[model samples]
Structures are given as C-alpha cells and as structure tokens.
Target chain A: MDLIKVGMADLAVCKAPQKLITTGLGSCVGVCLYDLEKKVGGLAHIMLPDSTQAKSVQNVAKYADTGIVATIEKLMALGVDRSRILAKIAGGAQMFNFAGTSNIMRIGERNVEAVKKQLEQLKIKLVAEDTGGNFGRTIIFDPQNGQLHIRTINQGEKTI
Target chain B: MEFENLNNLQKDALKEIGNIGAGNAATSLSTLLNKRINMAVPNIFILPFSQVVELMGGAEKPVAGGYLQVSGIAPMSMLFVLPEDSLKLFLNILIGKPMSEKIQLDEMDISVLKEITNILAGSYLTALNGFTNIEFNPSVPALAFDMAGAILGNVLQLYGEVSDYALVIESIFMEEEKEVKGHFFLLPEPGTLEIMLQKLGVVF
Candidate 1:
C-alpha cells in the first residue's frame, strides 16, 4: 500500500509497509513506535497535553494521554508486543506569547512531559527524542528503515 | 469610556462585520497557501456558551478543540473556538498535502491548528480593533477540551454568564477549487454592540 497521510488529531498503524508519518507539529507532539520483530509501526500526532479535561470518550484519542494509548492499542492489535515497542518523539515548541499566569499553562512543554510520563507508565522505552524550541517542526517516520526524520523552520532535516 | 450595551438591532447590524474580518483572514491564507481564497458571506449568531456544541452541526463531532483565551485586567476576555477537521485541512494545505485523500484529525494536526488559530485570531482582532478603534490583545492559544460541557463549565466558572451573549461567525474558504467552512467566535462586553452601532452611525 502507498504511504498513508495522517491528519491532525489522528493516529495510524501499519504492519508490512513499516512506515507511518505525520507533519507540521508546533505545540503538538508526534510519537513514533516500532516493533522490529513484528514489523509493526504506529504513529500518533497528538495536540493537547492531557485528556483528563476531555468532555467525552471521543476526545480521548485526541489528547496526548488517549492518543498514545490508542496508538499502542492499534499496534498490539497488529500483534506487536508491548515490551518490544520503542518510542521516538518530536515537537513541543512554545511558538508565541509569554503572559505570566497562562504562560505556565505551557501546552508545548506539558505535551512533551505528558508523553514522557505516559510512555514510562506503559513501560515503553523512549530511545530517542527531539523536542522543545522556538520553531515549528515537520517530522517523518519510516518504519521500514527504522528512521525518524525531523525538519525545523530554521534547522535543516536531521535523523533522530 | 464605558462600552455600550448590546441590543437586538446592534446585534443584527454586526452580521456583516465578520464578512470584512474573514476577508482579511482570507488574504492571509492566500499568502500562506499561495492560492487565492474566495470567502463567502459570514454567518453570525449571539447565544450562550452552552450553545457552541449544538451549533457545530454533525454526527462526527470534532475529536479535538483549541482555544486562544485572553483575560484582561479590565475584566474583558475573548475565547477563540477551533474545530479539528478544518484544522487538518489548513495544515495539510501548508505542508504540500493540500488534497490528501484521507485526512484524519490527530495530535500533530491540533498543534498546527492552534498556530493557524493564532494567526487567524490575531488578524481578526487586529482588523476588528482597527475598524472599531478598540484596544485589546489576545492571550496565547491554549488547548481546549473536546467535550463541550467541560469547556463551557470552565468558562462560566471564570467569567460568570458573560452577559448571556456570544457571537459566532461562519465563512466559506474557497482555495484551489475546494470549499471549506471556517468559523469565528466573539464574546464581547455587554455594551460592545451599542458601541459598534454608534460607530456605524445607524440612525435607528
């Protein structure tokens, strides 16, 4: 099958194709997970830091907490073992503004922290990460090559 | 100066206000997408916070939501509402994937959506301020929950009924032969409508 295009607030999993990708992550985070033996890969492009404030079950997969868990569930559905999955994450930039009280709301930093905490709780080893900066990022995950590429506004493309 | 209170006549008069606002927004979108955008007449409404969910007509409710909430020491604040699907399309267009066959809303899409909201809201506010000679600044865009209930609960708790008025404007975005609807919300102070009518010089 051709490479699938994943949209905002979405998640996707692939088995044989071995490549799952997403783009344009500002305050959002793109989490790439791969199980080499099963050749299963999953990617989640999450926006919000947590789903605790979500109003419905539908938004669970839209927030970081639910988005990551949904991705893992899809990968496991593909027969990938939870223990064998390794994670790589990118994007969480503070794009604009510095108001004091709401500044601490910091969705970008909170998203990164939420991803880390969620992955650790799931016992998913985070092998690589590229996060936190003043710029936006465009990321691609190639499961076939086990490579994740990140391109920033000012920075050139580099493998993570 | 005290802001004038909003009434039915003033509320109806400002229906065309967002037409100009969206036109300005479309200009920005054209530059960013490198495609001309044909924006349509804007849809305007005034309701309470609880009406936001019912207003977004569809069975497939948006999985994600974003907000640019600003609270001024002057006791005035603004909330910008963003849906997830339109956000995906906006980002996909920017990344050279403007015509993706299957666009699914995801986390990555929401971040970009927030940025886009920041741009649109900034432009909208600037246009409104410039046109009305009002002085206001937007706070940073924050993550709004998908659940309408919780989101409104938080707003009501902080703002206290907000004078029972909310303004929602809808416009169609036509770019590269594709048409999409974009919505903007304004919950101005009680007297904002009256001030706007006076500025427009409505004889009535």
Candidate 2:
C-alpha cells in the first residue's frame, strides 16, 4: 500500500487502490472528492481561504475554492459525472488570535466557507464534513474503498 | 535614531533571545528527531521584509517560511520564522526519513512543523512568561513563502503598529551526523522591548 502524504497548503489526487492523506489541518481546510464510478479521489489541503490575495492565480489550484473546483473538474475530465462525486471536508481550526477585535483573521473559518461555497456552486453535496474548531486534524482517504480516516491530537482515529 | 544604532541594539537583543529560543528549540527537536540537535548562535539583522532575497546571500530561490505565531493578553506579540530547507531537514531527521526530492506539503511535514512550533513557541513563551508572567499560546504553524516581500507585507498588514525593527537570527542545526541552518525573527516594538526589559528588572 502506497501512502501519499499531503501537507498543509498542498493537495494530491489518486485513482482506485491509491491513497491520499493530509495531516495537521489547523486553521486550514482539506477537501476530499471521490468518484465511485471511476474510483478516483483528490484531496487538497489549503492554508489560505482565497487565492485573490496572492500576487497571481498561478497557484489558484492551491487555494481552497479554486483547488476544489480544479480537482472536481479534473475528475470530470476523467469521465466521472459531477453528480456522482461525493465530498468530505476537514480542518479549518481557529488556532490563533487576531490583533483586531473582529474575527477577520479567521482564515480557518474562511477556508471552510470557501470550500463549501465552491462545492455548492458545483452542485456537489458535502456528504460529510469536519470543520471549524480549536483543534488540529489529520485525514486520510482511500480512493478505492472511499474510506475517510480522521485523527486529531489526543483524539484517536475515526472514520467520517 | 540611526538605523545602525537601533539595529545594533536590536541585534544584541535578538542574539540573546535567539540563543534562548534556539536552545529550547534544539532540545525539543532532539526529542522529536530522536537525535542530538545543536543549533549555532544566530546571526542578527534588522531589515525590511523585502530584503529576504538579498539575505539569501545567493543561496537559493523559493525559500520556504515556517511560521510560529503567538498572541496573548500581554503587551507584546510576535512571530518566529524558520527556513524551509532547515525545516525539511529537521523533519527528515525527526522522522528518520530520507530527504525527499522536493519539499512539497505532506502529512509528516505538516504535523512536524505544527508540533515544532508548539514546542519552540511554548519554550519561548515560557521563557518570556517567567519575566512578564503573561501566558501565551502559539497558533499552529503554516508554511509561508520565503520571499521577503510576501512575509514583510504580511508583517506590515498583520501588525501595522509594529514596524521598522525586525530582529532576525540566522543559525545552524548540527546533530552528530547532520548539519542544517535555521532562522528566527523577533519583531517587537522598541517600547515593547523596553517594557519587557524593565519587567525583567534589567535597567539600561
């Protein structure tokens, strides 16, 4: 079994019998998209909520919104029906304090919102989601079995 | 208010602080990496955020920034930035894994960096806490671009009131069989430092 590790602000895509895992989702969001028919799944771990903040959109595919859209599109290009795609989301913890009184520095919340909005825009239902808290999460997805494993500090592994 | 004069004071403070922080960070890394980790005293600097490229000293591009941010009710708040390659090496040593071709985001790296920040930041805050008695918790570290512009830009935007003085400490990490370099930037307002020193009972 080959284990592909996804880091913060990174993403990975795999077909059946392949596995994608992302760890340490603190204030970051991880989106897992799977297609039962094609047995293909893609996972993206995005640090920031939006790519517009960056100088260029070259790494738009690395941001939460654009990354999920691109990953879904890739699955579509591979002949998987968009409607048949199931999504699982995790991470987006508010791990710090903002200088301002407002919660504008809530990048984790923003990442979760952005991913959900994009998924909704694409008409994909977030079948399962683990998001927004004061803790970090580690997630694993098996494209072949469509199993999602999530782990957190002081919290053992559990499937969502 | 000469830049050199101010920078010299900032440099001394940065070295002293870096020695304490890096010493603690090294101890933590030794436990996590399961090896004896030695960190060289930091090379101090006070410069604008845009100076990263030059500071690289013709080393390499696409430098990675491993950031550990801590905020508290205290009057002082700051961040610590670790180099990407150094972090990569540190993670490799910590996990006993061979160096990968690229430092792409991976689970091992994320967890390691996050934990590293927790350890390093905790140590730093504890050290500060002793003098100030202010409690602080660090935010999970996320990877940042090593480019001076982006980091400094974020610094400006993040702490608008605190600027013009960034104490950067450049150091090397040495284990029995390995050697790597690292950086620690202490950005504090002059007033903040003055207050902290006063609190520490260090007059001058």
Candidate 3:
C-alpha cells in the first residue's frame, strides 16, 4: 500500500490501498474524509482555526475553516458523492497545560470546534473522532477501511 | 520587516543576535549542569513551514521539547529540543539516573527538563535584552516528549495564520565528550524582526 504524507498546513487525497499519514500533530487537527463506495479518501492537517486571523489569504489547507472546505471540494472533484462522504478526525491536543491558562492558548480545542462546525455546515457526518488531550499524536488513515490509527507517546496506538 | 525580503545585512544581524543569545543560554546550561557545553554557530533561515521539521531530522523523530511563549514588545516563541537518546543521557547527568538507551521519562524527569528549559530560555532572553535593550519575559515552559514535527508544529501555528514563511534561528549544542545533544529554536513573530532591527540600530 502506498503511503501519502501530509505536512503541516497541507492536504492530500488518494484512493483505496493508499494510506494518508501526518506526524507530530500537537494543537493541529487532522481531518480525514472517506467515501466508502468510491474507496477514495482525503486528509488535511490544519494548523489554525480561522483564516481571517491571517494577514494574507493563501494556503487554504493551513486553516481549519478553509482547509475543510478545500478538502471536501477536492473529494467531490474526484467524483466522490458529497452525500456519501464521512469524516474521521484526530489530533487537536493541548500538548501543554500552560496553554489552558487563557482562551487564546486553547487552540487545540478551538481547532476541533472549528473543524466540527465546518463539517456540520457542509453536511458531512463526523463518524469518529479522537481529539482533545494533553499529548501529541501521529495519525494514519487507511482509505480502504476508513480506519484512523492514532499513536501517542505513552498511550500506545488505537484505531477508530 | 518581512522575513521573506530580508537583505543580507539584516540576515547577518539576526544571526548575530542568535549567536549572542545561544551563547548566553549555553553558559547558563553549563552552569546548571556543571559541565561545559559547546554550541555551534547559530543559523538563521527563512523557510516554508513544511520544511521546518526536516531541520530536526524529520517529523517522526522522537524528541523531548520545551516550549515557551515570550510576551513583550517583540513577542516570539522559544523551543528546546533534545533527541530521545540524548535526553536519556542528559537526564542521567542531571539527576544521576542510571543510563538506558530507551528509558521512559518519569514525572520528575520531565520537571527537571522543564526547569532546565526555563533557565536556559531565561538566560537567552536576558542576553537578547541586554543587546537590544528590550524587555521580554518568558512564560512558563511546557514540556512534551513526542515527534519533532508535532512539537514544532505547535510553535509554528501561531505564525501560520499570518504568513507562509517563518524566520528561524537554530543552534545546536553538545556536551563535551558526552552523547547529549540538543537543538534550540527561536521563532520571532512577524514585524518583531523590524522591532529588533530598529533596537539594534539596523535600518532595513
């Protein structure tokens, strides 16, 4: 099976037997969308929750709001039915407790909320999620099964 | 002060700032650990966010990281990263723990590392303040043992909303005759560069 790597602020789409991987997801959220019938999948590593906070409009995959929309549009362009698309999300960890001391520090939770809201607005069902913790995660998504395998430092590995 | 358009003189000025800051940090670390620490010349780079992890030997490299947010006129982020193996060696030296290649860090170990990061970051900021005469204080350092890419992604996220490129000052340090090694990263917020330059009396 071929593995496609997604970097920070990046996104990728692939077909069955091709897995999507993103590493070291601290406060960032990884959104994975898959169509069971088409066996097609897309993954986005979104760094921030909103694009409006940015100075310039660029790299739609870097922000949760734009990244999710872009990923869905990419999936639809590949002929996957928007109605059949389901999402499995992972990451969005706090990574540090000091970040919880203030609202601006809670980027992980904010990213998760923004991602979910974007999915809801797009009418995509969020089938599974493993998010909101004080640890970093590396995630791999198998397009064939739509299974997200999450790996953390002390917690070992879990698939959902 | 866009990092993307920095002239050679500005880049050199940043490198010098990194040099002085890392030098002070190394001294503080040496004093804390009571061992001589040698640091390489600091390197300043303007890189796309995607390539930042490659500086630490890839996204998946197991690393222990300490992150701090500096709040002041020129806000920035500071990161101290040590490879897992190097961390074991460092801990062994710091607390007289028996050495093991793949030892899992306990709570006490994490605390010690965080304290070390705090002191080092404090000294680094102090030196920069001395040079530029600016007041910047570091927040409580947060520790995470994870993939290098992940820890750095958290630091870079603050800048991701503003620009695609990041100004990174990187320095590598090693304990003399020991296997302990670490990387220090200084990521100043955008427009802060101009502030720093102006304070240093550099026009750009």
Task: Give the per-residue lDDT of model 3 (tens digit) for B1-204.
Answer: 567899988889999999999999999988878899999999998999989889988888889999888999999999999998888888888898888756687899989989988988998999999989999978988898887877888788788777888989998988998677899999999878999999888997
Candidate 2 per-residue C-alpha lDDT over A1-160 given as tens digits, one digit per residue, 9 for 90 to 100: 8788764445678887879986555556779999977899988866556666655564444577778878877787778888899999887765544345334356668778888888888888788887876555667898887888887544456888
Worst 10 residues of 2 chain B by lDDT: B156-165
Sorting all predicted structures by TM-score, with the top scorer first, yields: 3, 1, 2
Worst 10 residues of 1 chain A by lDDT: A96-105
- What are the per-residue Cα lDDT tens digits for candidate 3 across A28-104? 99999999899999999999998987778779999888998899899999999989999999988877667447654
Between candidates 1 and 3, name the one with more favorable TM-score: 3
Best by lDDT: 3
The sequence of per-residue lDDT tens digits that candidate 2 reaches over residues B1-204 is: 223354455456646766776677678767776777777777666654325324543212334455555555543333444455565676666776567765564676666665665676677667667656756666666544333323333332333223323444555557766555555555554455565555555555
Q: Where's the lowest-lDDT run of ten residues in candidate 2 chain A?
A: A95-104
| Each prediction's whole-model lDDT (CA) | 0.61, 0.61, 0.89
DockQ of each: 0.03, 0.02, 0.67
The per-prediction tally of clashing pairs is 15, 3, 1
